[model samples]
Target: MTVYWFMMAWVILFGILAQVSARKVCVGEYLGEEVYESRVHLFVAVVTFAVIVFFAGARSYVADTTAYIKMFNDYPLFQNAHDVIFDSSAREPGFRLFSILIKTYISDNYTVWLSIIAVISGICVMVPLYKYSCNFGVSAFLFMASCQFTWMFNGMRQFLVAAIIFSCTGLILKNKTLLYIIIVCILSTIHKSAFILIPMYFVAQGEPWNKRTLLFIGCIVLAMLFTSKFTNLLTDVVEQTDYATSVEEFRNTDDGTSIIRILVESIPIILAFIYRNRIKGKLTPIVKLSINMSLIASGLYVISKIASSGILLGRLPIYFSMYNLILLPWLLRNIFDKKEKDLVYYIMIICYFFFFYYQMEIAWGGLEYASKILNVKY
Candidate 1:
């Protein structure tokens, strides 16, 4: 717990410094100054990246971290890549191959492998953020505050896949269909959930709060209300995939989606709706995509709430929830009125801070059980 708090403190401190620096650059650009990238901007981004990698790479405390370590230890290094790739196991093939390669060549240091994964995932996440966010600090702060950063310590392959998919946002915005499809195909090999983005690309291009959006949200609501029936109807289809067994297991669990999580996810969507006009012109494609993805995630949360099979479906939202980190910051920066902008910014920061606290201390407890390095004893 102490370690978690300490880490959180650093995240907050560094995030503030980065936000301040980013705000200056934004202001300079607004004033028609030819502001190239600033030292402070580069420094903060590097520091934030390093901090996340350090924690994510070093920690062995999260539940999934242990499973990942055990899987790496148990995997046979000499296994044929083709066989592993085509294996019917529940594990993602790309991750399996990753583990096999590490075991085959790297020292049997699971920590090193974990760290490498963390660095790759972190870079994939941060690069888009640095390039696209209206204010880098707010985006970074929201990244931590929304619990997206902490989630990186767990859900290793899913986050990795999501990060990779997220890196293609520029392509999606630029309407580069062929290249985007190619990238999505590569990333889907890492996690099947990534395939959802193929359709989502089109869905995100639609106007926000329009008839199409309303219809999409309505369908999700209906699905959530009849989750059991929906799951039953989809069971046969689900059984045909690699996730069949896991889906079966989750279907039997009684847990539902977190209400607090639903609320947290909804805040940005609500804000986007309220400030739609202000944000419509700036970062147009990216904002539209973000709003669309966020709505999809919220709809998933609703479905998670009413389904006995909610736990499995719940994982689908993170792919979209991450966009809020970008969307919210952009909204804060683009507010029409200066005083209102500052007010909204501070309010957003405070709300995100509390959300982060709740996530670490309440919703997901025992966050301090992490280690700074590998524990050889297992």
Candidate 2:
């Protein structure tokens, strides 16, 4: 536990230091005015690894780790393998499949397999994010380092799917819709939630809308209403996995205010609407919508007691939070150019750390405490 804590502290320290030593990323690179720089990508990758290591290493194996352990323990699920073609399990079959392969290689050493898979998957995902951040600049970097990406630390398979989405957003935004769809389809095998972003990818590619895009919203609402019937499509993965029993017994535990969501979500939506032209300078309408939605969801969850456990609201915000991976660092870079740059930057970093720390405390209290215990300095 003490060693893990020191590792995390070192990661955070070295991550920020690496970022500070790098040059500012240029907008021209994103627009094809200039070529992408490997140096910027390298810097972001190093920092991303550090940040990811801090959170992941700080927390002893839990959620995702447990899932893999269960899969190995449930030998029949792997050997009998009834649904090998299409996994209707709670977790994406893709990730589980990887675990199964690992189980074959290290049949007698599940823990080692788990650690190895976790590290490799993390680096695979981080590389793409690092490249995208390099192409877009510091804004993307900061957003990735914040609470949003940190939360994903616990859900390995889902995190990989989400990371794939983030990695491809740069290409997706540049009109590679066909390729984006294919990539997301592949990610869907790991986590069904990845499909939610399929529509999001298209929505993100276009400009802001004056009217609420209720089509997909309506579809989601309808799906939620008829979740039991359509459970096959929306949540089949959960059914096949260890989560099957729990997910079936779950209810719409959320009774929070939609007003706050509407309000906070309005910030970015309105910004995209008002400055639809300029917001395009660094962000997309989907990014703005996603960020605002997360803020609203987080606020609502905080205010509501019942839905706190459902965590469905939290999921919405998590999806949106990825945009901040790039947005926050850019904001910090700007602050660094201001009068009290050093002071402001340090304050912001501390604030971000505490903000993320507390947000995790609220999101998964036990996990937060576990991380603190593992990362205990002394």
Candidate 3:
């Protein structure tokens, strides 16, 4: 506990230092691109690694880490990889195999493996953010500081996959058709819910909030809500199979986080909708893709929780995080003239951070409890 407090102070002190240095490089008149990029990347890498190590290491004391911790020691794969994956009926076969490989090959250190996963997710987010920032000469560091980037670091495996798939969506420069197919195929392996995003490529190309778009969103929500018989069908496939029921148990244990994220994370996205036309011209194809994904993800989140026992819609908000991190920077860049509105930008960011803090506390029980135990007084 003392170490936790010390670590928290250390992180704040160093974080401020990094932020100051980054701002100097980013907001300067003589902006040397190379210097700015390196400084920002180093700061992000350092802070990302520190946060993961701190929370994940103290997770038993600070967060409800039992679910993730279980994956580390469970070598269900090396012993029965094929039976665990193919003969089984769960949609998470890709994750199952990946977990097995981690258990088999990675150092027995659970924290190390989780850190690696976190780093991968963080880097995935950086790719889209970088591309979007490059498209319009905005500050990448400010973009990184968005709630989406930080919120995702705390989400376990589901967000990791979301980050990867969402980033891939943003990076579709040329050969978009091939990129779309490949990313969707990859994401489906992690969570079948990702399959829902495939058609969004076409949907994103259309105008926002159109009659057809709203109707389609309404239909998917209705389907998720009224389609429990289909979900039950999914469950039957599980019962008939011989894979461990353990994964099912893990998937079903919701802890009430997803529901909270759906309501909370959508606030910014809702704001985006209100300012749609203003941002429409400013937003690039990838940025537009992200916004569309966030909207569909928001709709999915409404009824997705019905199957939390087997699947969850709560994670859909992460699609918002992926899109909005870059989108917010673009929006802010457009709304406020850069030279004079830096303070306003900071204020907006501060308010958004408050939103993120409360959202994560309500959504993730581990974080909720940690805030309480640390007596941080909110």
Candidate 4:
């Protein structure tokens, strides 16, 4: 707990420091308005990246990290690496193949593997924040404070795949749908859940509060109203996809998503809807896509809570949730007038920090960190 708490504090403090030293993100103005164009302070961002990647890579256990460590060790040595990677029954060959190459060429130790993976995942996530976020510092804070950083610590396969897909934020904003879909197709081999993002490419397009946005809301409402029916349909789809028996495993274990998390995810989209008309006229393509993705993430979280299977539906939102880190900071900067902006900023900081503590100390209270290299465990 202390390690995580310290890591979170260090990242947020540096992130805010980076915000203090801004650079010109664009020449004149953003969104056709003469607003703060200077952003993405590089020095502090690199610092934040280092601290985060270090802790993530050094971890001995955090939700599925120990499992991944075992998996990495059990992977056969380089002699049969090709067969293992190319095996027809391989669920996600890309990651397996990647692990083999690292083991074959680099050190075979899992520490080396975890460190390398941590670096890759960190870069994938941070690059997008550097490019799209209005307040890179705030977005960095949001990433940790919102507990999205857990993706780096656990769920390595899916989150790593998601991080790679997130790095292609440019394609989504540039309307390079075909190329983006192609990328998703390739990454789906790393984690099949990535295949879900294929249809989301279309869903993420267009203006905020569009008919598609309404449709997402409608889908959530229907899923909530007819949870049993939705579960059966979802289960059939899962079966056909041929993933493990996650459906049955979690079918009756519906503790549901935390209401606190749902509110945290919901706030940004709610704010967007309130300021929809004001923001619509000024939104950059990236911001628009961020809002749309935020909408999807929030909706999924809500449905996960209302529906019968929290784990099943909850897993789906990671595809879109990173965009909330982008969306939230942008909303804070642009949506309010000058006087309200400061208040909103403080309120955001307080709420997010509280949520961070709640998640780490209570919800995920058993989270422990151990590392031989660091010579510390807590």
Candidate 5:
């Protein structure tokens, strides 16, 4: 709790400084409307990136950190590498190769390996936020308060790939479909779940609430209404994948995503709906895509709550939920008129603060970070 508390505070401080020190730039043209961009301060990026990467990298314990460390410790680096990476039963060749290279050339200290991964994951996420986020401070707050930062602490393999694709968001706005798919395919080697982003790329295109977006919403409805059938079909699909054995461990056993999270993640889209007409004419490419992505994320959360197999479906939302970091601040700034703005911001701050407390202490039972370099302990 000590380290996570410090990390969140540090990021929020620098996140505010990032906005204070920002410069505006044009990213690209969208339908002849100039796509405005905010260039996040490099110094702030360095500070934020350093704290996040360090705390995450230096961890010796977390939900899955020990498991990851043990796996890295046991990897067959350069010793029968083929058998290890190319075994039919094997997967995530990219992560395996990435780890092997680090062990072969860099220090074998698992901490150093974790640090390097933290560097990659942190940079991938930071660069995109640096480029795309209209309000760095607000985005940073959401990034932490919403518990998206847990990905770095818990699921490095998939989050690494997700971060990589997230940095390529400019490609989506540029309408580079083939290139985006190619990039996703390459990243999928690291985590097969990266394949999920392929369809999402198309869904993110065009205006908000388009037919594709409505169809995605319809699927969520269908998933909720026919949970057992959805789970059965999902189970059949999982049984065919590498996760077949994992499915046997538990089927629709874990409790669903909490209602609090659904409400928190739903805030941006809720505001968007309220101000739909007000913001329609002002929609930019990045904001539109973010709106759509936020909707997808909220819909996934709904499915995760109602569907039989909530745990499996819940993880899928992170791929889209990240965009809420971008969309939420924009809504707060643009959707509300000036008179109602300060009140909205106050409500937001109060809500997220309590939510963060609940999530950190009550839900996770408090986070503990241990690091020899920093002489920190749980």
Candidate 6:
């Protein structure tokens, strides 16, 4: 417990330092035009590297970390791409082929594979986020504090796919249809869920309060109210896919979405809606996408509440919810006046700190295994 709190403190301290460093570099710049200097980028890169290394090196701290290790250890070295792609497993071919290729040429060491994944995922997430966010420091901090960083430890494949999709934020924002489609198609080979975002790219770019937005929101609400029935209807179709086996048991489970997660994700959307007029004019394509995604995530949470198989469906929202890391900071910067921005920033820091605390301590078993990376145990 002591170690967990200490780790959290370090994360918060680094976040504060990132914000301060960004401010120093942008001191003379106009409001909302602060560019992240090369030094600031270096700081971000170093922090990201350190965090990824910690996660990659961790010893069974997260539940799926051990499972992934087992999978890598058990994976066979395929002779060719054809063999790997045609393997009898339900796992996506992209990652399957990647695993085979890595094991065939590189070391079969699971830690090495995990480290590689950590690097790719980190770069994919941070690069786009830095490009799109109004404040790099706050966005990075939210990425960690919101538990999205920690989530990568568990859903490695899904998060990797999501990160890749996130990297195309620029293409989507720029409305480069052909480019975005190509990217999403390539990424979908890693995880089929990436296909869902194909239509969402256009949906996200829509006006916030328009008919289309309201119609989608209403549909989401309707789905929530009849989640069990809706899930049952899809069970047959879902069962026919690779995901069918995985989602089979969840078909009848009554598990609901996490209220804490819902609250954390919804806060930015709520703020955006409240300050729509003030910030709407300032909404960049990236910001617009973030807001739309947040709404979709919130709606999914509501659906997750009533669906017997809600937990399975909940995974769909994560691709969007993660963007809150970028959205929250952008909204804060655009909506608040200079006088109130500091107060709001501090409040957000405190709130997100507790959110991280709850995630690591109360929710995820106190990060008890985190110290294992340092060969220390409580």
Pitting candidate 1 against candidate 5, the one with the higher TM-score is 5
Instruction: Give the TM-scores of the predictions, in the order they appear.
Output: 0.86, 0.65, 0.65, 0.94, 0.93, 0.87
Clash pairs detected, candidate 5: 1-367
The runs of at least 3 residues in candidate 2 whose Cα sits more than 4 Å from the true structure, single-residue gaps closed, are 1-8, 23-26, 29-44, 47-60, 76-91, 106-108, 134-145, 149-153, 208-310, 332-337, 340-347, 360-378
Candidate 6 segments whose C-alpha is farther than 4 A from its true place:
1-7, 23-39, 57-61, 80-84, 234-237, 251-254, 368-378
Position 206, candidate 2: lDDT: 42
TM-score of 3: 0.65
The per-prediction CA RMSD against the true structure, in angstroms, equals: 3.6, 6.7, 7.1, 2.0, 2.4, 3.5
Model 5, 223-310: lDDT tens per residue?
Answer: 8788889867877875675456667665646566889989999988988988898888777778899999989888878876775445
Candidate 2 has a TM-score of 0.65
Model 6 clash number:
0
Residue pairs in clash, model 4:
none
Write one digit per residue (lDDT tens) for candidate 6, span 1-378.
564455455656665565566533332233457533312455654574365445545545566677778877777777645765786665587787787787879878776687778778888887876565556667767777787775567777888888878877777767789988887788777878778787776667767766667877888777767766776765665566546667756655546677787788899889988999787556655677788888877776766665644446667787788778778887777678998999998899899888888888787767655434467654
lDDT scores for all predictions?
0.73, 0.49, 0.53, 0.82, 0.81, 0.71
Identify the runs in model 4 with alpha carbons over 4 angstroms from their true place: 27-33, 240-243
**lDDT winner between candidates 1 and 5:** 5
Q: Which stretches of candidate 5 lie over 4 Å from their true place?
A: 24-38, 372-375
Stronger candidate by TM-score (1 vs 2): 1
Write one digit per residue (lDDT tens) for candidate 2, span 1-378: 233234346556555555565555443433645532323446555554654544454444555655555666664345655475265434556766766666665664554554564465556556644654432333333443243444444566566666556656566557787887888788777766667666565544343342234444454466556645644453454445434555545544433334433343333333334544544555433354443443333332332222332333334444444554444443334223566657765775575556445444544463432443344322
Candidate 2, overall lDDT?
0.49
Q: What local lDDT score does residue 291 receive in model 2, on the 0 to 100 scale? A: 39
lDDT for residue 18 in candidate 5, whole number 0-100: 88
lDDT of 1 by residue, 1-378 (tens): 565555567767887787666633432333344433322376688787677787788887676788888888777765555676568755477778777888788867888888888888888888887776766666776777777876678777888888887887888778899898888787777777778777767767767887767888888878867777886765665566545668757766547678888888888788788877666655455677888888888877777676644556677788888888877766665654898878877777788778878878887664655674644222
